[model samples]
Target: VLVIAIIAGAAYYMVAVQPFQRVILSVGDDSVKTGYFLKRMVASQGMTADSVLQSLTAELIIRQQAAAMGFPAVTAQDISDYLRNIAKGENETISDADYDKWFQERLDTTGLTAQEFNKVIEGEILAQNVQDTIGAQVNPQVPQAHVWIIVLDTQENAVSAKARIDGGESFDAVAKEVSLDTTSKENGGDMGWQVPELFSTQISSVIDTLDIGKCSDPVAFSQQDSTTGTTATSYLLLMVSEKSAAMQATDAQLSQLKYKAFLDWLSAQEASTEIVFHGLNGS
Candidate 1:
């Protein structure tokens, strides 16, 4: 009986204690053992084992941030709606039994119980809400360049127009006569209170560099060729009539800038967060 007990204890050590005692990886307080980690790596199919682990760690951090941001609680309806949205996107009018089967399959693939998966989904929803809220708070202060523009279809025409202006031809007359921009040509190319931020980066830079009351030389610009579906270049003649300091951003620009602010905020959070990974590759 003593020898049998000894054998049983040795078998237990070989099967359970020897392999799982060592840490393969960790994300903050959460540590993964070698056995479980290797299984996860295999389940990833093509994804690198380290990347999969890191992604999960980042999600954990995002969840913590979500909690601190006072995001609204995730309800059962939220999860149900999320799944229903998935169904809609997939264009599959699935039955309740089908959904249950899929959900169970997902649990099996993810190696998570229904409760754990629910928590993960809840955290995801909360994190998304927090990100959106932060993005909505971006109020970009953008300057308005009240400039007159003489847009031309080609550089040669634009250059000739500039030269004509330099040779004492009235800019207003030349703009009305030669500017291709019908929108502003009638008003003598008065591009009334142009916000550089609402335009392209190149146009913004050009606008920023122009002196007040100075006329810019013909600047080349590009647009997608609507007719031939190719690259098309144009020229612009800008005269900075009036300029103002930063003002409220336009709707589209505000949305873009706000999203950027949210990303920047999230990037900044990494330094303050306490995250550690202990693994053969991540120590």
Candidate 2:
């Protein structure tokens, strides 16, 4: 009877363990590899190999965090909303089944029960709430500016160009004739309503110091060519067309603000956490 029991156990491992192991291995090496990669993450130079057990623990922690923050638990509706937001953000069509299949595979690999996974989701939602709170504190009604930008290849060239403009040459004609940014040159360098953050520090500072309809001295900025990773020097000539007064936050805008604030907060939290890793295989 003992021998028979041993044989049964061996069979169980053969039928279950091997397949699961292969799935986990394949996921680590290929497309469905979130679980595998997660395990490989090191905390302070130590290995934290992904395991169903770790996932379960993480989920529990997330739940505790949520509860502590007075956030509601995650629900099916929450998941649906999250999925919709993801689809909109990615500009892709994804179905509920897609989310379910992806998460179910993750849960299977991480050994997290559905309830445990929900807890993790709940924690995430709660964390988002904290982010929302921070975002609400930001003054989203900050004014946007309509301006023109003249990009150049060098600082000397930008300075020369600015000299010409200040000497009474037409900004539009000079920009069209000399500016390297062909797209904007044709429009007389008009870059429509943009927030201060969108411009480089030099350009933003210059714009802040100028009145509307005032042209700035050529301010140096850097641009990277995405294809070749080449760094190019550029100059901006800004003309602030309009500046609006601060306005109240819209719900959609508030959500975006909150999301960004949350990310900043999360980064800070992660930086502060005491984390350590050991036995990093590759390292």
Candidate 3:
């Protein structure tokens, strides 16, 4: 009986403990064990394993690359303050007892030790710092277009609208009469001055080639219906009223540019870095 029990213990260790301790990711000399990966997987419930792994890889890369780039240091106090603010909630004050209870409950829910959770928070803070540092480098000025659009439910409607505009009917009058886009239809389809990047991929591709003071060929725009989960295609007739080679971007546009710059930098880092995955297939 004792021999059987000893055998069972050994088997459990080999089957469970060994796999958890196995290295699934290696970046330079640093490694991520299956246990660590599993914890992240649990925290990011509903995401595919590959996506979670990619995010984990990006987080690791951010830490390493940001350090290399001399990004600002994140102190233990910073993490503590973040946690404290969370515990404080909407009201201003929080007592020691309240914080302790909230912290313990969070740990219990996430199934992560205090140190492990703190490490996660640290990674997040570091990633934000990296984004800010890289984002600041984006230029505030960009080529922009002053544009107007008329959206219609059908291609025939778009063609008819174009004909009306071409046949001496005011673009604004036609747009307000037949356009389906509520946001801009009331305002004579005026989208205001904007960079191409602010638009969708499909729209951005054609915006650059459109001649000023002329309407574009009906551009197809596909949209997914939220209630029915069905995709619907719409047609857009666009006119560029004016163009500027170097317009100063708005505050919001500058913010978006900065974010794009940061993402571009991160993508470059991920592309150059060689990461090895071991025992990651089954999970």
Error of 1 at 251 (Å): 6.9
Whole-structure CA lDDT of model 3: 0.87
Q: Which stretches of candidate 3 lie over 4 Å from their true place?
A: 1-6, 23-31, 154-157, 222-233, 276-283
- Candidate 2 has its poorest 10 consecutive residues by lDDT at 23-32
Q: What is candidate 3's lDDT per residue for 1-283, written digit by digit as tens?
A: 9999999999999898878888888765567889888988887766677887888888889889978988777889999888899889897989989999998988887788999989888999999888888777877889899989999999998998999998888888988999999999999999899899878878987788888888888999998997676999999999998989899999999999888888889889878888888866323
What tens-digit string does per-residue lDDT give for candidate 2 at 1-283? Answer: 9999999999998775544343222211122233333433421134334454244333334344446667766678896576466544565766667777766775666566666555455656665666666666777776567778788877788888888888888778778888788778998888676666434567767776678876787676777897676997677777787776564455665555566666566555445543223222211
Q: Please give the RMSD to the true structure for each candidate, in Å.
A: 9.0, 9.2, 3.1
lDDT per residue (tens digit) for residues 185-246 in model 1 = 99998977767765677888888898876668888988887667699788999888778798
Q: What ranges in model 2 sit over 4 Å off?
A: 1-68, 75-128, 198-202, 224-230, 245-259, 267-283
Q: Between candidates 1 and 2, name the one with more favorable TM-score.
A: 2
User: lDDT for each of the candidates?
Assistant: 0.75, 0.61, 0.87
Model 1 spans > 4 angstroms off: 1-45, 72-77, 90-94, 108-116, 140-256, 281-283
Clashes of each: 0, 6, 0
Error of 3 at 229 (Å): 7.1
